[model samples]
Target: MQNSKLLILSSVWVEPKSSAAGGRMLQLIKFFQSIGYSIVYASTASESEFAFDLNALGIESHVVQLNDSSFDGFVSEVQPNIVLFDRFMLEEQFGWRVVQNCPDAIRILDTEDLHCLRNARKGAYKKGVLFQNEMLFTDVAKREIASIFRCDLTLMISEFEMALLENLFKVDRGLLYYLPILIENETIGKFDRRLSFSQRKDFVFIGNFLHEPNWNCVQILKNEIWPELRKCLPDANMLIYGAYPSQKILQLHNPKERFFIKGRAESAEDVIENARVLLAPIRFGAGIKGKLLEAMVYGTPTVTTAIGAEAMYGNLPWNGFIADDNQAFVASAVVLYSEEEVWKNVQQNGFEMVKERFAEHSYLYDLQTKIGYLNANLKSHRQQNFIGMLLQHHTMQSTHYMSKWIEEKNKK
Candidate 1:
């Protein structure tokens, strides 16, 4: 018997070694392959160095152009049994066509993060203010919600978001599935505390500067948190690592400030494992913090804000300190840096948390079972989702016409 055909629509290229999202997507594909699925990965973005080698994975890859009729034919010819959208925006763009041509296929949306929440928080940050209730009613929410409605199911990474969809949005429980960050298990012996203490130095923070939240958090530290930290812990170095650092970010680097922009780390694990303590004083951000998770996997404890610590610990005791206020954040960093016993305990806590929650012992099996069960009953599942059907119907009518219009325009 032939394996099930699965088509993945992507917002960006998948390159595990390059980015958090790309790496996650690469894992998903591998998981699917492990479960006997023939994959077809498509993306609207053009190829880049970070793009995954789909050929090596034995998965068919295609470049898709937005607002073009060619995508309609692409789906018709491929006729996959399952279609996974990488993020909310990709769903909004290509969702209807998938429904139009491959109505029988199960449409799944992979929301990397709640864009609505992130955008709302960004708006609040831009105004130098707090998030307002009115922000939820903005356009992003509508598009995001509509995208969810259009899909058979959505893969939510954060448990906090799963609750928001249920309590706040009244989203149907059937429409959302909780799928936390997946990791490969490496139950390596805990790092030697003495060796860790002797090798560790400086306060470290790393994130992709392309993300608004990281840029904002770094600014907060430079202007507010780091200055105070330096006052208390004199002679301490605060080295920063991130990809796509802007000219604006470059301006913040200063030896006198004790804040050095070391650029992107050659290996995320190396920089994090070597750090004395990870420092993130985030005012507002959504989803699980990858830096903190990496810190945990690396046996490094961090001091971050409540938002940074959200949904990550999973009732497992945090591996390190969680502080919201600037002064408190500084104080925690100081204590954690100096007290070897305290630091050692947190490191052990981190290693244990990673092993228990994300050690990938059950990740593959659970994902395979749930996905296989859904696949077995895919038709009935779609029939039960009336909203998905309705959204698919209209998406076909409107987006289909607009795409034809663009294709015609392009010929001229």
Candidate 2:
């Protein structure tokens, strides 16, 4: 693997503080760097004020174009050993181009989370209906699943989603890899440094407001949860924190009611650590919740919905309480805030869950071994994945022409 290069195609530049996706992207970049792979991050998306400076980290950054031959030239010149699509959308947009230009490069799709599952849940929530399995068989699923099959391997962040792919969709196990968020070794030691139950106060909800689910969660808290919680503990405050707060979100802030909208937390950890209880009533979403994970790391007990806690804690006891009922949710938060012994015990449960489920050591070595093996046996690997090759051949024929047509149209 000497002189190996890993080219990452992102839809957005990394902004760790802005969202969990940004933080996850940075983690993957660092992982590639640690394994001695020269990295280049290319994106069609424009850079933001808060975007992480790739150049500062000794990683090359490129702004590439869509539906253009310029990307073909870029990929050919870079000649990356590995081409990683940041999400399935990137895969759908550029997967064919990469296959056509760089046949030898290992194609991997880093599915941030299953977008179809998220969208399906969103639709169900909006309709006030139970999410059905048939919902997963939509247009989004077709594109996403096809992208999974087209790639050599797809990285899944959640085990639940991984099972859904194999058991329901019949995606080959070899074509999917489970790669959860890697917690740092130093993070465990920081658990001792967290504020005691007495030092911390109130309930806190932190998430990226741009996420539809988060905005929905904040609305639920304001309209449904908080009013009931306040009735129980009239003095307790519920601090709503997140990045990219719009006018609509800001309007929800009422200082008299102590429902503070503290936009853009300077440090998610700092805020979570200082808070007595983290309350995230995420109604419907996919993958693991990063805020809940951070709460565990910071020793802040959380009271979240079943959907918020989904696929995170496994069979282990939750860090705090999991309640879907608004009344139960608020009751759990009030108790978690008021009782020291219960809160401390819940905090310890979080610590154990973090150590057991999310530690880097659990996955890093296995990932390295799998990648090395896959790289060594590329020819045979592709041969075994005949369906992928067939899909690539046929799907690309249509996609290839459409892209070329778009390129020509743009030239005129």
Q: Give the top-scoring candidate (lDDT).
A: 2
Residue 52 Cα positional deviation in candidate 2, in Å, after optimal superposition = 1.0
Local accuracy by lDDT, each model: 0.81, 0.90
lDDT of 2 by residue, 105-152 (tens): 999999878999999999999999998988999999999998999999
Model 1 lDDT tens row, 1-412? 1478889998677865455776678878877787778999888878877566789889899999898878889999999988999988898888877777887888888997888887887788778887775787778888898889888789888888888878877788888887777667543444443237768888898888878788888898899888888888887899888877899998999998889988777788878778889988877777777888878777778999888888888778788799987878888999888899998888888877777776666567766666767778877877787876787778778878887888799889
Residue 34, model 1: lDDT of: 74
User: Given candidate 2, what's the lDDT at residue 112?
Assistant: 76
Q: Each candidate's root-mean-square deviation in Å?
A: 2.1, 1.0
